[model samples]
Target: MAELMEQSLLAMREGAQATRDTGAACDRIGSAFDDMRSAAERLVDTAAEISTFVAAIDALAQQTNLLALNATIEAARAGEAGRGFSVVATEVKALSTQTRKVTDDIRQHISGLQAHVTALVETANGVGARLDDSRNATERANRHIQDVEGAVERNTASMDMIAGLIAGQKDATVKLEEGIASTLTHVSASEIFANEVVGAVSATDSVVKAQFASLEAFEIKNYVLHRAKSDHTLWKKRLAGMMAGLEGLRVDELVDHHSCRLGKWYDHVADPVLRNHPDFRALVKPHEEVHVRGREAAKRYADGDLVAARAAFEAMNVASTEVLMRLDRLIAAFQ
Candidate 1:
């Protein structure tokens, strides 16, 4: 009887050991299931993140489309002057369309990934239901979640690069606007200068007409007699002074000095007609008494003569109307 009792006790020990082993197996299966549940949750989060990224991409694409449309409208309003801009606008529109297409494609890819993830999660759940544990499945689900996160990070980086490119384009557009403004300003200045030139020419014409009228009314014989006598007296004094200064000077030196003085006189006479007048023309000729008188005067320190040079220079500084009249006559004859 004692032998039978010992054998029953041994059998009871074996059965307890088997029960403990089954309990340990169930615990491992439960841990695996817990891990799978956590992985599924992580995958869902990743899908959510991707969805948000896709939505942001969509918003950006829409903004790009709007900007392209605005550019096109502006180009159209600019007419023929904006032909270059219009071409740029068309290129921008095409780029926007391409961006939209890429965004749509990304959206579709994300949606498909989400769908696949959902199906995977459902399959894992089914496997968990049929299996005693889900530890291995949970680990696989977690790996998928990590892959999805990596994809999201890449997409975000791509979007950032695109945003930076757009900002650069905006800067270029601003510079183009500034260039157009400068061109308009230059065109305006040219028009103003042209108008001023026209007004100046008109005033000159009027002055010349007035001067001609004045000359017509003068008594020619009386004027000639008076001018000739006054010229002779002035020339005699000038010649005497010049000869005295030339006591030690050579003929060539005198001639050079005289030529320079004549050039200065020519510059002093701003009015071409006055300088070329018949009376003044005859006086400045080489070998003439008047020319010799001027050369002689240059050798003397005469206050009166210095005063005359200053007066001549001052006379040239007249109103624009008078100067323009002389310039007009010169231009007309040349033409």
Candidate 2:
């Protein structure tokens, strides 16, 4: 049992370390996305400036057209006196028409290019948003792993204490066995000897009770934490689906969907058992803060305040992973 427990502990430690590494990688990825988003925004701005230049060219084409018309009129009044000038005016008018057509074509192409750049900017924003959320989730997982490690450390200390008590019990049992053998051989067991055996048995009971109580606590911890892990996974899957459904849902619908998800998790999975655990109880205020902020983010989104939503989501996401990982590790220990 000891060897098995040690192996399990080692595996868990390795897993936690791996998860921490993954979180750091996720943060790096998020940073890269942020850089990309900034680049995309700059591209959009440059494209907008190009669009302005196109507008200026369009205006210049109009002015040239007006000038060509005036020249044609002046040449017409000159008649035979300005025959060459009339020919030149005609050429100018044709050139003006061609210039206008070319400018119109340029305008169309620039408009298309602007649309594509705008779309690229929006795409970058969405990807950055998702990456930010992923980073937040990973960070939360890392924190929960830390909490688990702390709890495991405590448990380890408790196990060491229990080991000491067991060692004492083993010594007492050996002495008792020798005493029994001596008593049988002598055909006389003293009251003092009987009292010593009784004392040892009582000590055994006391140690068992202490260790048993701790082990029993694991039962409840195991159940709740296991349920929490499952629920966490479900919550993530549901959130992913809701995000994918963004195209079909309006702001209100999106908020409602997310709110309902949180509510169900709170009511059935989190609130029911989590609110009661001392560790989870301590986690409550922080978890509640995350939910409150997330709700605010949803409200901000509904109000057409994307910047506020993104900021709020970032805050909430960090808190969420911390809470989640704590719960995850608690359950993991029991398993």
Candidate 3:
């Protein structure tokens, strides 16, 4: 009978070990869920940043519409002398309207993607909760097994008395078997839960990959300083266009130091070493001067001060040159 009890106790120990292993598996699954949730959150942030870019594009479109309206008014004042200008204004207005509509569509799509990613995060949280519950149940089963082992050990220590307490020993063995059976059931349940969570994580990973693929185009940072230089060149052309009355320019279209692409990058750059570069620090003041003078140029032309407008445009050109030179230095340093 003692020998039989020893075998039963051994089986119960194995069952307990299995339960502990399952609990460890639950912990691992919970950790994976946490990682998934964190990744989903990062994707959501990326979508939000992209949405901000779309908003900037929309703002530019609205500014274009306003400029077109002003052109329309100026053309009206010019009467028959403005007939060609009026046609151009109508076309620009139509184009701006179409651009606004397209941006609106893009915003809706991004919002939908954000909603989906948020749902993915919530689902990951749910899986983590389930894993916690599984771990708790497994722990309870392990405790039960430990109790059964203690009872068997006590029975074994009093083996000489077992003949007189045969019935009691048999009863204890039956209880030990029942405890191990219960523990095995708990282990099986935990295993099932872990499998379910694995499937969920696999599905979430595919979704995250697909979402990342969709957003790959927005990571447009290659040759960013070069682009900034080009933006300044374009601004110069626009200023000349305003002076010749070849284009309608708004003072607000000369966005401030913080609103341009380079400004956005400068504000968000995570590398302290790059951000603290002397050339990087020097780019800001001249950049702001360019915008301030560009807007002044536009305002002067609007106020019919052609000479002051030309002077501001010249000053803006000088500031833009400084900005470009600093950008070149920074770019070369990086290269």
Best of the candidates, lDDT: 3
- State the TM-score for model 2: 0.47
Q: On residues 1-335, what C-alpha lDDT tens digit does candidate 3 reach at each position?
A: 77777777788788889988998999888888889999999999999999999999999999999999999999999999998999999999999999999999999999999999999998998888888899899999899989988988787667636665886679889999999999999999998896676567546645754664565567644367776676667677778767867578988777877898778877888888888999988888998989899999999999999999999999998998899899989888987
Order the candidate numbers by TM-score, best to worst. 2, 3, 1
Per-model TM-score versus the true fold: 0.34, 0.47, 0.44
Question: What C-alpha lDDT do the candidate models reach, one value each?
Answer: 0.56, 0.66, 0.85
Q: Cα miss at 330, model 1 (Å)?
A: 99
Candidate 3 stretches greater than 4 Å from native: 76-84, 156-335
Per-candidate Cα RMSD to the true structure, in Å, reads: 42.7, 36.3, 55.0
Best by TM-score: 2
**After aligning candidate 3 to the native by TM-score, how far in Å is the CA of 115 from where it should be?**
1.8
lDDT assessment of candidate 3: 0.85
- CA shift of 304, model 3, Å: 99
lDDT of 1 by residue, 1-335 (tens): 33444454455555555555555665677678768877876987887898798778778877877887898889899999887988887887788788778878887887888788788788777766755434444445445555655555555566667777877899898999999999999999987886576557546655754664576577553332233333333333333334334223323344431354333444466667666754444434422333443444443324345555333323322221232343344334444
